[model samples]
Target: MATDTLNANVLVLNKLWQVVDICSVRRAICLLYLRHAQVVVKEGGAFYTFGFEDWKDFSRNSRGDDFISTINYRLKVPKAIILMLYDRLPPRRVKFTRKNIYLRDNNTCQYCGRKLRTDQLNIDHVIPLSRGGKNTWENVVCSCISCNMRKGNKTLKEAGMRLIRKPRKPDWKTFVKNRFNTSEWESWKDFLDVAYWNVELEEDK
Candidate 1:
């Protein structure tokens, strides 16, 4: 009887696009059952779940137990399932490049903070690569072509240039948007705010 009970509660993950639960080890027994199982939440730290349904319905015509029951007898709450609520970590921060730095800085030259279009931007290494600075998020920024040329292979101090703002990693929301192209991710946007994305940095500071 215990084994039967466990089996009845088991839920599985399905591959079909209409399916919602991705981490479940068991599948809904039938299409009707699948449809009836409400999407409780999206799996991840990100609060992507919205417009989900709950598990109750009533016949419109009857109020005093006159309605016919449509629910299946064997259907049970999903068990052995760890529903993913949100992304556990923020999306990875990409290494800064000329193009990305421009986007992050809104096409503004970091040295002077003057906005420019794509053609006028150049990638500048905060610490010259010759001095063992790795190509990474912290060490790159966008500059105008003239500024970049004047600062070539020289430290900021050497070139007499100063950053208008410190270059740091972007938050998870931006990172995810940059990395993946899908409407599916739109549901999670509200949860990935600047505060949530910068949680780790806040802790470190």
Candidate 2:
């Protein structure tokens, strides 16, 4: 189980310590071998690391479970890695898609402000396509089944509907808030400031 945990996903950090992406254990080990990145060992974890010398002794090492051996080399699966030269920040724009639309709306119907399950939600065009509305982020919203049926082929004013909020492209923070999972990214918490629903904070009282 420990070895499986060791083989779990690894977080990749840029030179500035900002999380840029994730990588597999095999890829992390390759980066370490190529000297492009360094493994990060959490505090109180004995400070072990994967490096060029970890490849020696092949089968003679007693701690084989900590590493993957490739005939002539062996190195521990990386938990997290820091790129030595990757300094660019992540792109500002997020991809546009149905899932993104739901995220932008927080899975709530824009018309009635009702929260519903994903399966019960539908995508609505703020300005009907037949009436000249383009399918861009600024013109689309998450709608409930009832609202969608109620507003079919009609404008909001025409259908006697009001929007809780206007549709617009979400900012980078909001995009990330909807996209990332903190549980799977525990190794990245120290480097990122994203506040997830599952995070625990000190009691104010």
Candidate 3:
């Protein structure tokens, strides 16, 4: 029970209250103890912030399975925390990787348009590497094993195949939504709005 409580997921927000990352309960507690973060509690459609000592007091009367017991007291495992100083997210880019490619394409074959399990999918080079195609977002797409085999090392015209859609770099907002859509943590949904986090920076004129 103790181990499970410490390893439970805690949604982390920046000082601006924008969803930033997901961390372990242990990390969240450490941050709280160090005065680097505060636990966020929601009640009656409003959110409240609590410091370590305050949170300890808040947990005293709380009865639930989601808590850790120490020698002196029990601490409720916090569902979310806000970093006291972290106000900016690092510059964002959807990572170029096979898994991201599958996500961008929705795990559906570009040529045959069949959605397949990961085991049945392959990352295909639209213009084969043998033909000097670079491994890039616009060059690679998800393909089923059958379509991959059928289009092996051949140009679309040569293989008598055409793509359903042209692959492009995925939008950052879409990528964030798809990557961090935490359905299990209902509290997180209130903070994961793209409009909140994706505010465009005003440029100096």
Number of clashes in every candidate structure? 13, 1, 0
Instruction: Report the number of the highest-TM-score candidate.
Output: 3
lDDT of predicted model 1: 0.50
Cα lDDT, model 1, residue 26? 31
lDDT-best of 1 and 3: 3
Count of backbone collisions within predicted model 1: 13
At residue 79, what lDDT does model 2 achieve?
58
Give candidate 2 regions above 4 Å deviation.
Answer: 2-11, 16-18, 23-36, 39-80, 85-89, 181-205
Question: Model 1, 1-205: lDDT tens per residue?
Answer: 1333333322222222121222321342233244533323344653121111222221232244211233442222332222233223322344444566666676789998788888888788899898989777778888998999999999989999899999877654564455433543463344344353443321111
TM-score of each: 0.45, 0.57, 0.68
Model 2 Cα lDDT, one tens digit per residue, 1-74 = 24555456787877776667877777786787798987766657443334445533322454536566566555
Q: Is candidate 1 or candidate 2 better by TM-score?
A: 2
Which candidate number maximizes lDDT? 3
Residue 178 in model 2: shift from native, Å? 1.8
Ranking by TM-score: 3, 2, 1
- How far does residue 4 in candidate 3 sit from its true spot (Å)? 3.8
